[model samples]
Target: MDGTPAAEIVSEVAPRAGETIVTHQRVTGFHASSLDVLLRGAGIDTVIIAGVATNLSVEGTARAASDLGYRTIVVSDGCSAGSEAAHSASLESLGLLAEIATADELLTAVHTPATV
Candidate 1:
């Protein structure tokens, strides 16, 4: 599955220079992968999750990250489920464990400078 078409990252969001890419075969990136170790090494305490299968892979990874004591944030508009109902339900449930924000809100927060 490594070199398969489905596994390829689209050009629109391809990794840029100086970006670290971690590949995981498990449902959650943190499982059976160096993602957790890499994050810890980088001293990153926050995680922003966004991907397909809002009720499955997305939710699973977010839950795992939260359980690992990371401040997890899922971008609502950045994920999608099989159905709108499913997506909404997953988002609601995830809200209890993680902060759910729209893509615009996330962008604003990312671009905003931190005040001392």
Candidate 2:
């Protein structure tokens, strides 16, 4: 399988029309990739991460974002792994480092008026 080409992203999870795709071979999205630069170039100070393998890439990316001085938010329910236990456990660990929020809660917060 050494020569086997890496599997490409499937259509279902593919980037949409206007969304750019950033591919990386590392477990972490920020490792040896332009993701951070691309995001910063777009003036994105806050990152909402969601993808497969919650305990691996997603968690790594979220931690990297946090270390990079970004307001990182990992969409708890938006991520998945091989098992529910792993997913929950990873999120638990991730919550200690970054904010863990549901899609609904994030949407509500975005729409809610600021008290200030």
Candidate 3:
């Protein structure tokens, strides 16, 4: 599944319009990815993570982000896992390393423009 199409983002959730999407193959998205360089170039010191495989991808990214000197937050409700139990457990474990919040809370904290 590593080099297959299934490993890529689904067409149903593809980026549209001005949305910027970065795809990474590894568990820790920072390694071997342009994410860290892009973030630094853009002066982005924080990262809000939302993705699948709560225990693996999400956790790995958050940990790597934190280690890379970035403030990382995991949107608990915005992410999904193979099982609800796994999702909840991953959130709990992630809380130790990153700030956990809902999509509503993050939206309230940072307002996005109607058109970007």
Q: Which is the leading candidate under lDDT?
A: 1
Candidates by lDDT, descending order: 1, 2, 3
- TM-score order, best first, reads 1, 2, 3
Candidate 1's TM-score reads: 0.94
Residue 36 shift from truth in candidate 2, angstroms: 1.1
Q: After superposing candidate 3, which stretches have Cα over 4 Å from the reference?
A: 1-13, 16-20, 112-116
- lDDT per residue for candidate 3 within 27-77, as digits (tens), equals 989879889998999999999999887888998999999899898999999
Per-model lDDT: 0.95, 0.90, 0.88
Residue pair clashes in candidate 2: none
Q: Alpha carbon lDDT of residue 91, candidate 2?
A: 97
Q: Mind sharing the TM-score for model 3? A: 0.80
- With a 3 Å backbone cut-off (N, CA, C), the pairs that clash in candidate 3 are none
- Global local distance difference test of model 3: 0.88
TM-score of each: 0.94, 0.84, 0.80
Runs with alpha carbons beyond 4 Å of true place in candidate 1: none
Tens-place lDDT digits, model 1, residues 1-116: 99899899999999999998998887788998999999999999999999998999899999999999999999999999999999999999999999999999988988999999
What's each prediction's clash count? 0, 0, 0
Q: For candidate 2, give the lDDT of residue 58.
A: 96
Winner of 1 and 3 under lDDT = 1
Please write out the lDDT profile of model 2 over residues 1-116, one tens digit for every residue: 23355566657877888999787878889999999999999999998999888999999999999999999899988999999999999999999889999999999999999997
